[model samples]
Target: MIVTRGSRLPLYLAVPVVVLLAALPYLVAPPVTRTLVGLFALVVLASMWNLLAGYGGMISVGQQGFIGIGAYTVLLTDIAGVSPFVGIPFAALVAGLLALPTTALVFRLNGGYFAIGTWVVAEVFRLVTVEFAAVGGGSGASLTGLSALGPTLRGAVTYWCALAAVVLAVGVVFAIMRSRLGLALTAIRDDPTAADSLGVRVTAAKRLVFVVAAAGCGVAGAIIVLDSLRVQPDSIYSVQWSAFMIFMVVIGGIGSIEGPILGAIVFFALQQVLEPYGVWYLVVLGLVAIAAALFARRGLWGLATGGRDVRFLPTGYRVAGSQGGVSGGGSP
Candidate 1:
């Protein structure tokens, strides 16, 4: 049976249920809880990257472009007189919308070129913002008014929102993988030329995933900016965002939903323990990712789980000519 991307349970049921159950922090509300919220946000960003690069075969260095857009979207919307909570979704939408044009330029390249193009695009977006001195320019902008809400409330709100965004992103990806389009995407990712020969529209699938990934990044970016109450072009657009993403996916296990989430948990713990190491933090992260890529080609979970006995994502699939599409059949 060919259980491809198009056969998972509705991600809506899984993602939101987990997110709601994860509301442990709202009750406890501590510095540790806030850190966990922050960790989930990174999980969102990293998972999106893994989905894009791992499953979709699109490694984008410019995911931060959407990140900045999302942050700025929230900032701009708040300026237009909306509450921060409302401003967040609005920002995410705007970032997703902006990705339309950006896609045209970046998709013009391929492979390593494509990755570099994304980085350049991020820099371009950052530079444009910096040039607009009215909005705090190079020094960056602030979310000071959010602070007025009080630390505990602000933290809780942002944390919940982050959790929500992560759920939304994960759900969307899971759904996409289950749709016919996702079937097409899986083929393309595995072998673009071969898939194209078989009539899958590789370019369009890649583009759709890119836009979806961008939209998810927007929510993540907005939540992060809100939490920081500041937005510096350089920092928000830093290549480090890409680095963190690569670290999580590689170490956790690229191309699996569980991988990035697991990777983020490991990453956050490593950060807490190595907080005093300063620059070494980055070095350790790089080493971890590289080691995984070299030794554990399928990722940590792939190693631990040992080849497809379980899929949190149950892709519905069937043998090409079966009487019915079977439930929970795995990759073709």
Candidate 2:
């Protein structure tokens, strides 16, 4: 048997799924289309968080900082005479650049302190954005130029953009996790001191992960405002963004790509059903997350998959026989 790290079966399955999703705009009703736009954005957020905390061993409650910044980037750039559509990438770039200095300051702490430090940094971003008055300050603002487009055209564009963001976030992560950098990330996550001693350049790998995760979150933030046509400092920068990400990653499975996808789906389903319940929905979500943490530490994906090492998006390495016969397997 040709041993592989990730299951080729998932790749085969993805072909038809991609085709179906591509045709979804035509097939689904407007409500479904809108729901999917939000869904894909959640996937992007959860995936980025998973990359940062699960693989890179950086637990950050501050990712909402990037999301708020990214949303503001879209709004501010649009105010500056750039199309919000074009500004999405620039938002990612700015968030990535900002992460360099942010990381420089926060990386000084370790363990739980590091986590708290990230939260503090995010609050600082939120507060700073509030003072900018032009972008609605703390009051928030609506995206203006989009109204020039017909409703149908704007919806279609936003839907497609959301789809693209999802693909980009997941694809970038899959590509990274399959490369040499993935190996370094795994080592660093597992044991930083050992990885460092073995010349793994732990700090560099963590920093790269930080930047990429920030960029991904930035793109997600842009997508959110692009679809909703509104950006608010409080709503976008709320710690709830980080909470949702942690819930998805933890309940789905932190170390695996499929986990976030599954987690987002589950979370979305709950949101749709229980949202009317207001505070009760949050209570339920918290209960579910606590249950997942206590019972299924590897997450629901781990429980569903059992001990089988099958992966849809394989990022790990495989040991193979020279003749492509039966052999053992391992992750990168």
Candidate whose TM-score is highest = 2
> What local distance difference test score does each model get?
0.79, 0.87
Candidate 2 ranges beyond 4 A from true positions: 1-12, 322-332
In candidate 1, what are the lDDT values of residues 35-142, reduced to their tens digit? 877787789998889879987898888898889888887777667667767878787788778888888998889999999999998888898988886668888887
Cα deviation of 278, candidate 1, in Å: 1.3
Off by over 4 Å in 1: 1-22, 316-324
List, residue by residue over 1-332, the lDDT tens digit for candidate 2: 23343445556777788778878878877677888989999999999999999889999999999998899999988898778898889889988988999999889989899998999999999999999889998899999978788876777778888888888888888778877788899999889999999999888899999999999999999999998999999999999999999999999988889899999999999999999999999999999999999998878888898847656777776545476543223344
Error of 1 at 282 (Å): 2.3
Decoy 2 TM-score against native: 0.94
TM-score of each prediction: 0.90, 0.94
Looking at model 1, report the run of 10 residues with the lowest lDDT sum: 1-10
